[model samples]
Target: MTEHLDPDAMLVAYDAQLRAHVPPVLPAGVTAEHDGPLLRMVGFDHGGFVVPYRDLSGLDSAELDALIARQRDFFAARGERFEWKLYGHDLPADLPDRLIAAGFEPEELETVVIGPAAPLARPPVLPEGVTLREVSSRADLDRIAAMEEAVWGEDRQWLAEGLEKEIAADPDSVTVVVAEADGTVVSAGWVRYVPGTEFAGLWGGSTLAQWRGRGIYKALVAYRAIRAVERGYTYLQVDASPDSRPILNRLGLASITTTTPYVWSPAE
Candidate 1:
């Protein structure tokens, strides 16, 4: 039976799950600093400075505005360009559209899906000559990153670096796996098992164009779920793109809600 869920309630549940499980994978040199009611990070990337913000609810409107302004000043003083990522459902009703007024532009909406970890434990069948392997070395990591880059058309250097850091920081908490055929990776993904949270997040599920519809992606997801359950995670969550949503749906993951980001970039 399809269980009907209230969108608002689902959003709250999804947010809590995300906050608990998938804490921001901030880039290197990006420190997470809390300023009373504001949780922000500053990443000193060669591209410029990236500032990502999360709402800290203890503050009233006036205090929140003051904190935002202070962050802007701090970054400006460092001669860095700033970018703010505002989640769609996070804007307070009483708060003015100051971010937009500050020139933030809305980006595409993404869906947050969550479901039990059990469904992913089931074994998946891949096409002939394909096999799944868990990555354990720097060489494997590079290969996985390269496959992801080729599949998604994005430079995955950042992702590889982040994963390497996580594995080094907490070896038991991170897992990267790839599906390969005749020594070439065709699909890949990773899962992060966050302590103190009931969720495990699946990330970077990219498959080669020629590999679509062959159950490689689903098998990768199942592999992660199995690992998540083994580590006692009750929920599996993903910020799914449209290409992956249908597969997740077929796997019984419910779409909790949509998450859109409003971006404030220096160029805008």
Candidate 2:
């Protein structure tokens, strides 16, 4: 499927639809600011996130430096950390270096992979002792956070809070699912249907290390794809990690570009 896909065309649509999109509504405590040449999503329990799709190629170094500093100061003055998302195809080739020089630390680079959803909407094939189920509740969200903590060996309490906000903002736009073994959470993932677009984003497919390589991750993806198709969404998207990129590639999605988060903190 990927062989027939035009990466350039996919990126064109992605930029036009997802990148250019500004949220029409946000839940309480969250707000969007359309600063000059930038759109910043702020007040998340996790922190702020700058939309990755802006064009900065026209700005010279000093102009760009001022722009970057403005964002850093905006968040810092609020005593918060925020992220500026940079895509690999973004012009002004030295942008990353400039961001680093300005004290923004770069996070891991992730591939932005996408493909039509219809092809991935197959019936999931789960291994023995595991079952897939859609969930909605603070309890379920807490369970997912615990599983995520075990998967990454870190505190994930914020995940529960963030998911709650997302679900509250628009329950129809998001679907959360978990894979369980003997009633214990083993793997999980979610789908968020991008409003007014053909895309549905698959996020947070984390499985416990003990359960890795057991078809659980792929099954969760299949479940999300099925949900996407049923919701009238035509395509699927993922910010694929190195571990997930190969699986998504085999599942028919191909990377169109890469995105790295350049983070700045008010606190050292």
- Candidate 2 local lDDT, residue 142: 98
In Å, residue 142's CA in model 1 sits off its true spot by 1.8
- Model 2, 76-138: lDDT tens digits are 889898898899898788889988998899999999999889888999999998999999899
Q: Mark the regions of model 1 whose C-alpha exceeds 4 Å error after superposition.
A: 1-10, 20-30, 42-65, 73-85, 93-97, 264-268
Give candidate 2's whole-model lDDT: 0.89
Clashes of each: 0, 0
| Best model number under TM-score | 2
Error of 1 at 197 (Å): 1.5
Q: What C-alpha lDDT values do all the predictions have?
A: 0.69, 0.89
